[model samples]
Target: MNWEQALGSKAELINTALDLLLPRASAYPSPIHEAMRYSTLAGGKRLRGAFVIAVADILGTDGERVLPAAAALEMIHTYSLIHDDLPAMDDDDYRRGKPTCHKVYGEAVAILAGDALLTLAFCTLSRLQEKGFEPGVVLRVIQEVGKAAGSQGLIGGQAVDLDSEGVKVSKETLEYIHNHKTGALFSASVRCGALLSGAGDEELQALSEYAKGFGLAFQITDDLLDLTGDQELLGKKPGSDLAKNKATFPGILGIGEAIKLAEDQVKKCQLSIARFGPRADFLRGAANYLLTRKR
Candidate 1:
């Protein structure tokens, strides 16, 4: 299958796994469950989950062998999105072309929903052992994902980003924020797949490098899109970064320069995976797709 087709197939598989993993919307404590499904089952690129599956594919592992990890990553990503849209955070009204969890389920339930998804992610990760993976490998995957989503990674970047609003930040600070906020999980996703597939140190290192460049390019393009993209295509309101005076690549480097930098990162991403040749085509396509993605 081609890259786009492969991604679509993987996303479908992830959606099915996520649906089965989450509590039913009609179950007890229905509101929270509903909110959890509301945000997660909503459509997304599912790129992080796809990365996990794709890396496993390259290593000759069946995607099903690592399906739990992929699903967990998506749940964690959705949980982050729910919290990011809260009034105390980005305060977004819409995501994935629908009203945000807080807007639909009330702020209290939305918070609980995010919390539920986060904990569920860890619970899901534990299932890898049931799939016959080694205990140590499962533990390592859990640790990697937990650290990426914790105060040292995603949360740290978010905290710094919140603090940097309306303040001029150096390019170094901007890189740190992007690397942690977005790149950390990207790294974890790739690493989890590699670990699950029993990849060698050399393979893992190369994929890690690819993920780093991919994450940075993704964030830069995201920033640029907020400034220049159509609102209808974006699903969420455009110009949110500008509204908050958030430090972004476009804000710091100018639009032309930001675009150039993103292209550079994409090149790095492709080069990092060049050793894998044809097997890395999916990953290379994904990196290039970042530059032109409408949402």
Candidate 2:
């Protein structure tokens, strides 16, 4: 499949897995469950899940073998988004063209919903052992995902980002926020997929480089979107960073420089995967797409 088609197919699979794994909306204490389903099941690119699936495909790994971890990645990403949109965080009203979880469920329940998702992500990974993945491999997946979502990774980046708001930060600090807050989980997703497929040291190294470059490009583009994206297409108000006085690449570097930085990162990502040839075309296309995406 082409990149777009592959993305859609992977997203469908992820949604199906998420629905099967999560509690029904009608279950006891349904409000939280409903909120979880509302935000997660809402349409998205499912970019993190798709990234995992795509990496697995390059090695001909069974899709089912990676599905559990891929689902976990999606859950983690959704959880982060839900929390990030809370009043204590970015305070967003909408996401993916729909009301955000907190907006529909109230802050208390939304917070609980995000907490549930974060807890569920690890549970989701534990299921990999049931699918015949070795205990050692499953443990590694847990470690990778946990580290990416925890203090040393996503949360740490978010803390730095919070502190950087309304202040002039160095380019290095801005990159740190982008890398940890956004890039860490992305790198984890790619690494998890590669690990599940039993990739060699060489392939893993290349993918690691690719992941780093792609993740940075992803954040840079996201920051740019806050300045240049259409609100309708973005599914939320633009200038959110400006409104919050969040430190962003464009705030630290000019728009032109930020755009150029993303372009450079995309080029490096594509090159890192070049050895995979046509098998890596979708990834190359995906990296390029992130560099130039409008939303």
Best by lDDT: 1
Candidate 2 regions exceeding 4 Å error are none
Pairs with steric clashes in candidate 1: none
The sequence of per-residue lDDT tens digits that candidate 2 reaches over residues 33-60 is 9998998898888888888888998988
Q: What's the lDDT for all of these models? A: 0.94, 0.91
Output the lDDT of residue 40, model 2: 86
> Model 1, range 157-209, lDDT digits (tens) per residue?
99999999999999999999999999989999999999999999999999999
- TM-score for candidate 1: 0.99
lDDT of model 2, residue 185: 91
